[model samples]
Target: MNESSDLQRFQELIEASAERELTEVETAFIGRMGFRSEQCRQWLEADAEVVAAAVEQDPLRTVPAATTLDWARVDAGLRRAGALPDSRAQSRNAWPLLPAAAALLLCIGVINAILRDGLSTTPQAPPEVVAEVLDLPEGDGSLILHEGDDEGVLMIILSNG
Candidate 1:
């Protein structure tokens, strides 16, 4: 039969198989069409060694097929073969860089602290401002005081009774 007819037959077999435990007629029909035993194996009791061989040969084999196998070993093998990147080396390499980076940062911080402390603690030379005396307007009792910083008091006399 053509591919289209084969596909149609395959779909009908799957729908019939889903309704109940596979009947002999369905199994015969499936086997005649050269279908894989993987789905049909569910209808029969599987040998442990046979199932394990399948899992060992192909890690992606069905999980129930793998139930009889040593999973940890298979899992490790699959991870090694799979695309998952190995991060152990990267993590190990990064750990060493952390202390080095921390040491660099500590050195920079210590240098900055020393510079800041030195700049702040050292006294600055006293300032000098030019001062000139000026007269107040008549009848306005005002006093302007220059207390070393060119800034001081400016106030009017209070006429307290």
Candidate 2:
């Protein structure tokens, strides 16, 4: 059985059109469902028969009323058989925040661009270059460390400039 085509036709009939005017695809589906196309076509081809027989027919005179069938097993069995694995794939949609995100990023970019010029133009004072040129509390001349016994040393040469 062409499960995909049959399912697609049923879906299209439910979504695209009503049951009154069945397309070729929908006819094929009803055929698979055990409905005779020739019987329905003969009934439809009879104009006076439709108006007088189907429409004007007394409800009490009919032997039995229309009946609805329960087909729960079809869907459950098809799912077990993996008839339409990709059916759920069509329903998923990506997040819709891209345009808003782009706008927010553009605002941030504009703000950053505007502030960059101001920050770059701001005056920055040069380093003193002579901090702690005097001696320490214990007569230390500079920020230097002297070690012994194979220890490390940190030397800071002071400049008057």
Candidate 3:
């Protein structure tokens, strides 16, 4: 066989050895080529190193054991960091007064609304002086005329003595 055909066969055997175990004839071919060529000897040495490393390595690592947690320590740490309220101290009383303040504000708003409504009414247009009538007695007398709160209602008083 030619030198190229021998080298090709050697490469095929090396590739096949990676996938599966080689037959005795194939192994003998590899050995003969390894002895004959320096390149083949280097390839054989690399393959041997890879196989040795794989064989020496452990497949699975041993896991650590499970441990229990102490909740009291966690709580103490949280309290020290001010993340939790102290059980011994009383909470602020301001929450109770919130409702009272809200009620007072509501009352003030209601009173303001009532006053605004009371003042909002436009004054009656001076009773629209449609006409005026004057009657004078022969002697001393007096007359007073004015509009009442009710629309179109008028009050008049006359006194003579």
User: lDDT of each model, Cα atoms only?
Assistant: 0.48, 0.43, 0.58
In model 1, which runs have C-alpha deviations exceeding 4 angstroms?
A: 1-75, 78-83, 96-101, 114-161
TM-score of 3: 0.26
Ranking by lDDT: 3, 1, 2
Best by TM-score: 3
Report the number of the highest-lDDT candidate. 3
TM-score for each of the candidates: 0.23, 0.18, 0.26
Q: Write the per-residue lDDT of candidate 1 for residues 44-161, one digit (tens) a residue.
A: 3336668777778784563555553576566667669874545564565564354445544544554455345532344643323222223443322232222132243222222111
How much is 97 displaced in model 2, in angstroms? 2.3
Worst 10 residues of 2 by lDDT: 145-154
Write candidate 2's Cα lDDT for 1-161 as tens digits: 46455455445654455546777866666555434344443433557666677665677666574444434455556767888454344322222244334434544554454445422344543211211224443222233221112222223433212
Off by over 4 Å in 2: 1-96, 119-121, 124-161
Candidates 1 and 2 compared: the better one by TM-score is: 1
After the best TM-score superposition of candidate 2, give how far the Cα of residue 64 lies from its true spot, in angstroms: 23
Better of 1 and 3 by TM-score: 3
Q: Quote the lDDT for 150 in model 3.
A: 42
